[model samples]
Target chain A: MNFPSKLIEDAVTEISRLPGIGKKTALRLALHLLKQNGAVTEALALALTRMREEINYCKTCHNISDHEECSICQSHRRDRSLVCVVEDIRDVLAIENTNQYQGLYHVLGGVISPIQGIGPEELKIESLLSRITEGEIREVILALSATMEGDTTSFYLSKRLKDSKVKVSTIARGIPVGGELEFTDEVTLGRSILTRINYSQD
Target chain B: MNFPSKLIEDAVTEISRLPGIGKKTALRLALHLLKQNGAVTEALALALTRMREEINYCKTCHNISDHEECSICQSHRRDRSLVCVVEDIRDVLAIENTNQYQGLYHVLGGVISPIQGIGPEELKIESLLSRITEGEIREVILALSATMEGDTTSFYLSKRLKDSKVKVSTIARGIPVGGELEFTDEVTLGRSILTRINYSQD
Candidate 1:
């Protein structure tokens, strides 16, 4: 669409660069910003610029952080011996929100996807191995996705730590908690049966 | 959602302030920006800031412009005798894109909507009248939406210009060019039949 102003055109071009936003949506967003108070645009611009320029990754876990180490890594209450391995910081946020686990996280950044030209070396696997070598983390839980890339990454990490003394485990694979038996996929249903736990364990 | 960093939280909050975007989508966009090269965020911020700070409305027609006057109003080739009045700059762009009209445009900023607390005085009606009174524009075309508010604004403008020497007209209300008659609504189909033109006139 033709914009009446060059400034609007430029703004739309920049906004459409984002994922899921197209030129029309970008134009609508630009016009919306124009309709709102100037402070709205100012605050958005300032916040985004600050985030891009000043945000840091945790040196220990590779999670997004404002400082050298993330809050989770700095907290003394978390179980230092347990580390949950995941794909990125979003996964870290998801697991953290659940409040089921109280351990540090090791964000591998991404998985091994040959189609995308990504391999083990492209991720933060070295840092994760170094953390395990430090001898503080006793168990590493693989909390990655259930996709093929996730399986490949898990296999590679397990093979690399075969000689290490750290115990490597993976999150349980089964039907979702509220899922009905009839609607559940066969593979997950089979896994749920195979990994059935003692009813009185809780 | 819980953000790993305060910077990310701030960015997501600002992004979600815009129309349509929610907290989850905002978080996704913030993460996507972080994953991309820094230049993407930098350019977006700069463009939006510049647009918000420096963009102007055409002094005469009230259309969004980078300068005092818009290109449509500045062009000498456009018909000075005919003026198309619209609700906003987007309408001006839409009509211009058709490439069928050679007349200039007068953006009313918005239609008169009592529910939204918008009135004739709040729009550029006075400026449009002033332009018409200058004796150059012989015809005024109301190209506003076909909504109730649009009709109200058109009636208001036509009433105000009843005594003026310039002729007042509105866009034809009929079914769209490629629309199927069987699927067309009753009111639109009725209007189309009533306003049917001579085939040889084209």
Candidate 2:
């Protein structure tokens, strides 16, 4: 589409470069910005630029942070020996929001995906191994998704930690808490049955 | 949703302020940016800031431009005696894309919407009238949308220009090209029948 101004064209071009945004959506967003107060654009541009330029990652867990180590990694109350391995910072935030896990996190940044040219080497696998070898970790829980990439990454990590004393495990997969069994996929149903837990006596 | 870092939180907050974007989508976009080369973020931020800070409006038609007068307003190829009144620059671009009309445009920025507290004084209606009064324009085509606000603006403009010598006309309303008559709404169908054009003869 033709733009009336060079500045608008440039802005739309840059905005539409994002993963999900298209040229039409970018144009709509640019026009929306043009209608708003100048302060809105100023804040948006400043936040994006500052985030990209000055953002930090936790040295230990590889999660995004404003300091050398993330708040989760630095907290003394967190169980240092129990590391919940995740695919990215979003996973860390999701688990944290639940307030159910007391352990620290090891963010792999991404899982192994051959089609995307991303392998274990491109992730924070080396740092995870080093952290495990340091000998404080007792259990390493792989909380990655159930996709092929997640399974491949989990398998590789388990094999690598086989020599170490740390007990490597994966998060349980089954129907969601509110999910009906009839609606559950066959693979998940079969797995849930095979790994069924016995009823605990009160 | 929670964010792992302050930088990520700030960026998500700012990005989500756009019309349709929500916090989750904003976080996804922010993380996508973090995974890309730093140059991408820099370019996006620079483009948005520069556009917002330096963009200009055409003095004559109020359409967005990089110059004092828009290209359409300054062009000798366009008919100076004909002006299509539109709501915004997007409308101008839409009409230009059609390639059917060969006249200039006058952007009102928005229509008269009392609920939104927008009135005729807030738009470029005064300048439009002055342009007509200049005695050069022979016709004023109302190319606004077919909405309540659009009709209100058109009505107000027609009443104001009743004493002027220039002819005032509105774009035709009818079933869209490729639109099925069965699916056409009652109002549009009725209007199309009432204002039906004669069959062309060789």
Candidate 3:
């Protein structure tokens, strides 16, 4: 589409570069920004630039942080011995929102995807191994996704940690809490059946 | 959702303010930005800020431009005697894309919507009237939408311009090309029949 101004065209082009946003949506967003106060744009620009330029990652967990170590990693209340390994900061946020886990996290940054040219060396696997070998950690929970990449990364990590004293486990996979058995995929159903827990006597 | 850092959270909040973007989508976008090269974020920030801060509007047409007078208004090829009135710059772009209209445009900025507290004085209608009264203009084509606000603005403009000698016309409304008559709505179908034109004998 022909734009009246080069500035608008440039803005649209940059905005559409983001995932899931198309040219039309970018144009709409640019126009929306024009309608708002100048301060809004200023704030948005500053926030994005500052985050991209100045944001740090936790030295211990490799999660995004404003300081040398992330808040979770620095917190004394968090169980440092129980580390949940995840793919990226987004997964960290998701698990943190659950409030079910009080342990620290080890963000792998990404999975070992050969198709994407991301190997074990590309992730924070070395740091994770070093952290485990430092010897206080009792359990290392593999909280990655159920995709092929996730499985590959988990298998690799387990093989690497076999000699270590840390007990390695994976997050349980099954039908979602509100999901129906009929709608569940066959593989998930079969796995759920095989890994069924015994009925509690309480 | 909880973010790992304040910068990420701020960026997410600002990005989510755009139309059609929610918190989850904003978070996803922010994380996507974080994963990309710093140059991408810098370029995006620069484009957005520059567009918002330095963009100009055409004085004559009120369409967005990089200069005081828009390219259409400054061009000698377009018909000076004909003016097509539209609701916004988007309509101007749409009409321009058709490559059929040779007339200049008068952007209303927005329609007269009392429900939204918008009135004639709030739009660029006064400048349009002055342009018309300055003489030599032969036709004023109302190319606004088919909505209630469009009709109201058109009616108000026509009534105000009744004393003028310029011929005022509206773009025809009918069943869209390739639209099935069976699926057509009653009001449009009824109007189309009432305003039916005769077949050419040639």
Candidate 4:
């Protein structure tokens, strides 16, 4: 770990602070930057700095955006009455890539994980409730992950919205597409069988 | 990946340009940055920019440094008559980590590789000879990698240095420390057998 220069040591230290990147990988990356054009390093630095300083969060849905409100929340083509709730902005992109849902989305930022010291108060639950109370939403889909924290957040949200007029539902849990029944996990297989839908010709 | 913000997209693109990182990993890193304090990203950007703009190459050995000469070349404790020739700064670092050598180093930048369009003129071979011709150096050790290009470069250098008074040698090639003989490669095993040294009490 003997660095030839303090500048390189500083760069390596900062880069290795990122998750999954170790010191050796950071040194390799720093050397690569040194080998490339100065403009490349300058551009990367400018991009990261600008991204950190200028990005905004949608005031309503809590997703990242270039403006005060995200494009999805501002779009007129989306069904405002049907809202799909997800854990973070990445989930919003994943669901959008599927092209299956046309409704607007509400990002919860993160689920309630007591082990991580994250509770419902730290999430965007209050804003989501406010959006639902605004009276245009008729259905709310809990699209969180299948982990314990996801289920806890979903249950909490369902209880909070029990008095509201909006019907609360959750995305179906089952073996993934292209998954074999023999290799599927027990809980998933049992749930898929219990919630099996009647077959029909498309 | 349908990033919600243009800033995030730009950051992801630049971060993904680094070796071993992909769009998904870039996005994950970008999100992790967004989740943390803004100062973290700013520090990384600043460090990279400073390193790229201010880092220098040693005028003598071509190793990276903050000054005109590297610490190794400036050290009076090292044997000026003995020199270890390596391909890059990383190789110099690797040898330094061993703590066995007490000589100076000369970095040739890279080995001769036709596939990479690198010739003798592209490296610091001429400088190395000039240093040797100055009459202070008595021995030169070639510590390049055990690869085809490394051998080609070594051969070319030996031909050029045959008329010089300095003794030429190469780092020994054998099975790696703690390596299992059952899984060792054939070429290394054969070479180790041919070049076996007599056992001695150290």
Candidate 5:
């Protein structure tokens, strides 16, 4: 991994710090950047510079944004009466891509992981509580993952929001749509069976 | 792919210009960079900035170096009397990694591909010619690929060095060691057969 010079070595080292990028791949990327036109390379560099310089966390949702408030929070077309609480901006984007979720989103930044020394205090739980107390929120959907941390967070939030008049619900979990009965695992099959709906006429 | 801001979009677009980086991968890389510490991100940005601002072509060897001479050319321990001409710095690294070749290298930057509009003038052909005439040169090895373009370049270089006192040679080609003959194709088998060595007592 001995580079041609200190500058080239530094660049390669920095590139190798990126996720999944080894020294060889970093060197390849660095060499490609070196060979290209000055403006093109500078633009890529400026992106990294500006991302560090200009980007900030959205004060309302804790999502990465250019402004104090995120675009979803500022949008007029989004429903203000309903708020969907998610783990991250990735979840917000995923919900947005469905086009069915018209309500505004609240990014929790991360789930409650006790092992990582992160509790409710580290999350945006306080902000979420304050937002719900604004009196117009009719429902608060917990759109967290089905992992242990996600479950713990959902349980804590549900208990916290129990006193409020706003209805609390979670996204459904069971056998996936179009899944074959033979291929269904025992855990999923058990859950599906337990949550089975009664379709008999009264 | 319409992002919230044009700056972010432009950044992703520029990053996608790198080899093997598609729009999604570019966005991932950009986001990862954004998530990094300000100083770490800025260091990469600064490196990319200076790669264009400071670095230039080495007049003698055509390799990317900080000064007029590349590291290989400047090194006194290298076999200066023998020159290994290759397509790019990657080839130089390949030879260096072997720790077998101690000769100086001449990076052509690219091969003479007429279809790609890369002619002899586009490469460092003149620099190579000048190096050969510098005296004390004993051998000129064409450490190029077996591709059509690589062969064409090797042929051109061999012809140009015909009048010189230096001995010209190409790297040996045959089935790799520990390779199975049943798996080997007819062309490689034929070459191995043609260049078959005698197993008689020394």
Candidate 6:
């Protein structure tokens, strides 16, 4: 069947691009947006506009931020000597929600997946090395997922930092198979974090 | 503890207002939009802006349109004699996907909901009656859900249209209990359309 109009079709196409959103969901979301008052729609548009105009990755921690340095990296209360390395900004948020970790973060952008054309160069591993070289980092927590790529990245990082005095560690992988840090319940993630172990022994 | 920033928090709050979107999901989507290049985010913003700036309810059928009348109403191939009444614009898209029906549509916006304060006056029932007064219309298909509100609206409409010579019908109740028409597979929705029943004795 034909679309009601090109604009409607375009909206469907745009909304479908969102993660986990399929064609039918996109159509519903588009129609829902269509029904809203101009102010609400404009608010979404303004948010999107602001995201484009203002957001940038913090040079220090690599978290999404509106400034040159993310709030997490700029905060004085955070322990700079304890850096948590994660795969993406989502992991940063997950860690922040725990409220128990007082350490700073270093986002790797993604795990090393050679099959998917993602290698060490594609990630921010170089930046991480420089940050640790500053000599203040006494501990580096690998908070990457429990996937194969996550394990490989942890092993690679542990090997690379072997000569350094920095104590490289990893969060426990007891969250069950196929579990994602993003979807894991907060309590479970918290427990896993509390039960962290040294990665060098593995 | 506090949101990354006030602007980020505000944007996430707004996104969370959407159906099925939680705080974490909202934050993820907001961050995703922020991470994209300016042009991609601008396109997303433009989609929202244009949807707000251009879309309005079709004066005749109450369906969302970029103009005074929707494309279906403007099309010459569609049967003006047959008007398919639906709960919302999403229903219109569902029917369109099947490529079966070639008639105009009337969006009621919602069904009769006593608790939600929705009634005949709240919807575009009077507008549907106004369209039928032209005498060219021969049939009216009630394509609403099988909820209590849907049943009430259908029964109310059948009674109201009994005096008119126009034929009244309802889409078959092939949809499962508590199931939304939006989630019903296209095949099931198509079968329901093929098995529609006459609501009036005539």
List DockQ, one per candidate, in order: 0.74, 0.82, 0.83, 0.85, 0.55, 0.46
Evaluated at residue A197, the lDDT of candidate 5 is 73
- For candidate 5, lDDT tens digit of each residue in A74-139? 999988988999987667767878889999778887889989888998889988989889887889
Best by lDDT: 4
**In candidate 6 chain A, where is summed lDDT lowest over 10 consecutive residues?**
A1-10
Higher-lDDT candidate of 2 and 4: 4
- In model 5, which residue pairs have backbone atoms overlapping below 3 Å? none
> What overall lDDT goes with each candidate model?
0.92, 0.93, 0.92, 0.94, 0.82, 0.82
Q: TM-score for model 3? A: 0.93
Ten contiguous residues with the weakest lDDT in model 3 chain A: A193-202
Alpha-carbon error at B76 in model 3, in Å?
2.8
User: Where does model 3 exceed 4 Å of error?
Assistant: A200-202, B200-202
Q: Which ten residues in a row have the lowest lDDT in candidate 5 chain B?
A: B1-10
Q: What's the lDDT of the predicted structure labeled candidate 5?
A: 0.82
* Chain B, candidate 2: TM-score: 0.96
The per-residue C-alpha lDDT of model 2 at residue B49 equals 96
Candidate 4 residue spans exceeding 4 A from truth: A200-202, B200-202
TM-score, every prediction = 0.88, 0.94, 0.93, 0.93, 0.86, 0.82
Q: For residues B1-202, write the lDDT of model 4, one tens digit per residue.
A: 7888999999999999999999989999999998899999999999999999999999888899999999999999999999999998788888999999999999998899999999999999999999998999999999988999999999999899999999999999999999999899999999999988889937
Per-residue lDDT tens digits for candidate 6, residues A1-202, read 3566567777777877778888788777777777677788788778767756765678888877768888888889988899999988778777888788999999888899999889999899888898888999999999988778998999999999898899998886557678888998887788778876669875
**For candidate 5, lDDT tens digit of each residue in B90-176?**
788778888999988888888889999988889888878888888867998998997899999999989988998899998877898
**What tens digits encode model 3's per-residue C-alpha lDDT throughout A1-202?**
8998999999999999999999988998998899889999999999999989888899999898988988898899998889999998889888988889999899999999989899989899989999988888999999999999999999999999999999999999988899999999999999999988779946
DockQ computed for model 3 against the true two-chain complex using alpha carbons: 0.83
lDDT, candidate 6, residue B103? 85
True contacts kept of 5: 0.59
lDDT of 2 by residue, B20-136 (tens): 899988989999999999999999999999999999999999999999999999898999999999999889989999999899899999999999999999999889989988899
Clashing pairs in 2: none
Full ranking by TM-score = 2, 4, 3, 1, 5, 6
TM-score for chain B of all predictions: 0.93, 0.96, 0.95, 0.93, 0.90, 0.81
DockQ of structure 4? 0.85
Residue clash pairs of candidate 1: none
Docking class of 6: acceptable
TM-score-better candidate, 1 vs 4: 4
